[model samples]
Target: MKPEIIDHLSEKQIQELCQLFQSTWWAKGRKLPDVQRMLNHSDLIVALCHHSSRQLLGFSRILTDYVYRAILFDVVIRDNYRQQGLGKILMEAIINHPDLQEIEGLILFCQPEVIPFYQKWGFWGKSDRLEIMIRPAAETELLQEKAGSLMN
Candidate 1:
């Protein structure tokens, strides 16, 4: 069945997304309340849903200035549903969405394995002159502890 792409999502749909995130590397510990709050604050949320059941087959969110920058987060497709071009469909919706049409940059970070997947849409890798840096959040203490132990 052809999935319908939508700009808004319900709480149940967000819960479904929380479940999907738990199965992935990037968002494994993501909480439902956090997901809800993020959805509430996000500039845009896009979902690809099964046309009949309205179940979310794919999802992504954009945090943008609507002018200078848009950062993509939590782009995912349900495990049983990958390799079907759903990601391309989701990206097309985001890239073509009027709110993002004039943004100077759209950015996302992904695992090395997925570089080629995003490059198809014109996303490039880190360059020598450009570096990405982040200040780790205090909320990541557990992850930091785990990594610290791994280094021991």
Candidate 2:
């Protein structure tokens, strides 16, 4: 089936997208925002829906300035629809979008097991020059508080 891919998501679509995200293993039980919040924050959002029925099947967002770089996030395909090539289709649509075509590079982080899947789109393990550093939200907040106190 040829899915209908939409560059702009509706309010209802945003809610459904969040629902899919919450249920996905990658999200780790995080609660996503509602439609208004999503619209306010997303630089670009896309959704794949059934052509005839208009049911949302997958969704993704890109954070970019239409140049230099773009980050793909919240890529999710509904559980029942996996293995149907929808993920790849959605990704292709985003990467090949007219406005995004000039982007210097695209990046995303996924679990080790899915590295192969992302590799199909040209993403690979980082080089030695790249080092990833992570800080949990709680730790970041604690450090910020300490700094604030020290400055007082």
Candidate 3:
């Protein structure tokens, strides 16, 4: 049986998504409200759900400008669903989505173990001129730091 791929999610799906995040290492301790807000602000989200049960099977999200660049995040499949080509399906949907067809580049970071999996989709790590840099992307962290500085 095949699963359904969907872009938009409902409140129940959001709760289910939080549970899905629990299966992941990087996303451990992810809270429901924060997941909801993350989904709200995301540019594009792709998820594959079980055909009958509607349980989420695979998921990935993208932050894109629809032209210049995009960043892919949370490309994960259910623990039991790996090696089933579902990741390829999710990647095909994201890369070939109409809105991103004209985009120049897409970027993502993953554990060294998954480098080969992502490399199949043309992701390469060797870049001399460009490197991925991340600041404390969460606003709450910035706010807390500011408050601490003011109190000191």
| Candidate 3, residue 148: lDDT | 47
By lDDT, who's the top model here? 1
Q: How accurate is candidate 2 locally (lDDT)?
A: 0.76
Q: Residue by residue across 40-140, what tens digits does model 3's lDDT show?
A: 99999989888888888888899999889998998888888889989888888887888788989998877778889888888887578965544454669
Model 1 lDDT per residue over 1-152, tens place: 57999888877788888999988765778899988888899988888999988888999999988889999988899999898888888888988888888999999877677899999889998778966655446657766763454233
Error of 2 at 90 (Å): 0.9
* Candidate that would win on TM-score: 1
Cα lDDT tens digits for candidate 2, 1-152: 88999977666666677677777555544444544575578898777998877778998888887789888887889889999999899988887888788999988867677889889888888678975554445656555553444233
In model 1, which runs have C-alpha deviations exceeding 4 angstroms? 143-152
Candidates arranged by lDDT, highest first: 1, 3, 2
**How well does candidate 1 match the true structure, expressed as C-alpha RMSD?**
3.2
Per-candidate RMSD, Å: 3.2, 6.5, 5.7
Q: List the residue pairs that clash in candidate 1.
A: none
Cα miss at 75, model 3 (Å)?
Answer: 0.7
Task: Give candidate 1's error at residue 68 in angstroms.
Answer: 0.9
**Candidate 2 — which residues are off by over 4 angstroms?**
28-35, 135-152
User: Which order, best to worst by TM-score?
Assistant: 1, 3, 2
